[model samples]
Target: MHVPDGFLDAPTSVATGVVAAAGVGIALRRARAELDDRTAPMAGLVAAFVFAGQMINFPVGAGTSGHLLGGALAAVLVGPWTGALCISVVLLVQSLFMADGGLTALGTNITLMGLVGVVVGYAVFRLVLVVLPRKLGSVPVAAALGALVSVPAAATVFTLLFAIGGTADVSVGKVLAAMVGWHVVIGIGEAVVTGLVVSAVIASRPDLVHGARGLARRTALRTGEVAA
Candidate 1:
């Protein structure tokens, strides 16, 4: 959900801004480890895909809308560090150029979608992978499960943020109910889309899919590596 300007007070906005900045800063340094000849281009593709996907918004509570947050998809296809960077750039562009989310709330947007979404999604993806069979096929399924949870997790985070800094004195309980409720539905759709995209990638180049690294054959990856 892209939060609008003035939704939160100055202190809360500043606080989230600091958190966002720190998160992006860390990602920038760590993402270098994740990026390479094959994966660098994948980062670009993921950013574009997420940008397009976010355009389709379904209403959630408190004037915020939920859409296909490609957190799980990106984290699965690319490493989490790079995925965070991909989404942070998308948020920056969306706020500055598209006016999709308020400029003042860019920090909150990044904090929500970039940091919280990617981190939570990636963590859950790894956890799910551990439980499932360690096959390339399981990568997509784990990603789907991650996508299902990440949306609501982000929503829950937003609710907490709103409760801490919401301009209107809305009831946290009601807000939580609405945000989580709608997000769960959105999450289901996200899971399906994430599964499909990841499945396609796995079918084509499982090697390029970061979450499939150990599972995807290294020899096959060498044979499958395409010119950058």
Candidate 2:
């Protein structure tokens, strides 16, 4: 969610800002190992796609709107560190150019949507893959489930942050209920899009997808097929 200014107090915003900066710093170092000639271009394309996907917001009742968080999608396509960085870049551009998220609240958006989203989404994805059938087919299913859970997780975290530093005095339970409820619906959409995209990429260019790399190698070894 793109939090606007005045939603959180100065101290909370600044704390999130520090957290965001640290997250980005760590991601920048880790992403280098994840990106290469084959995956670097795909990472750029994924960022652009996420930027576009977030532009279309769906009404989620009570005048609140939700859009694709893109953390799961990005982490599936790229690695988690790069996915976090990709979303951070998208947030920066949106905040600076489109004004989608407020300037002062940029760090909050980054922490909520970029750091928390990517970390939770990727963790759940890996966890799901452990229990599901370990096939190329299972990758998308895990990715979808990860995306489905991550949205509400982010929402829940935001509600907590709001409870701590919300500008207005609102009922924490009501806010949590509404945020989680609407976000659960939004998560379904996230799951659908993530599954479709991950499946499509696996079909076409599995070599380029970070989450599918192991499966791609196994298929290549089994079938003696090489990716073009």
RMSD of 1: 2.4
> How do all models score by TM-score?
0.93, 0.94
Which candidate has the highest TM-score of all?
Answer: 2
Give lDDT per model, in order. 0.89, 0.91
Cα lDDT for residue 217, model 1?
Answer: 84
In candidate 1, what are the lDDT values of residues 124-209, reduced to their tens digit? Answer: 99999999986888989999999999999999999999999999988999999988998998898889889999999888877788
Cα deviation at 193, candidate 2, in Å, is 0.7
Q: Candidate 2 clash total?
A: 0
Residue-wise lDDT of candidate 2 within 8-115, one digit each (tens)?
Answer: 999999989999999999999999999998789999999999999998887766777778989999998999999999999999999999988989899999999999
Model 2 TM-score is 0.94
Angstrom error of the Cα, residue 120, model 2: value is 0.7
Worst window of 10 by summed lDDT in candidate 2: 219-228
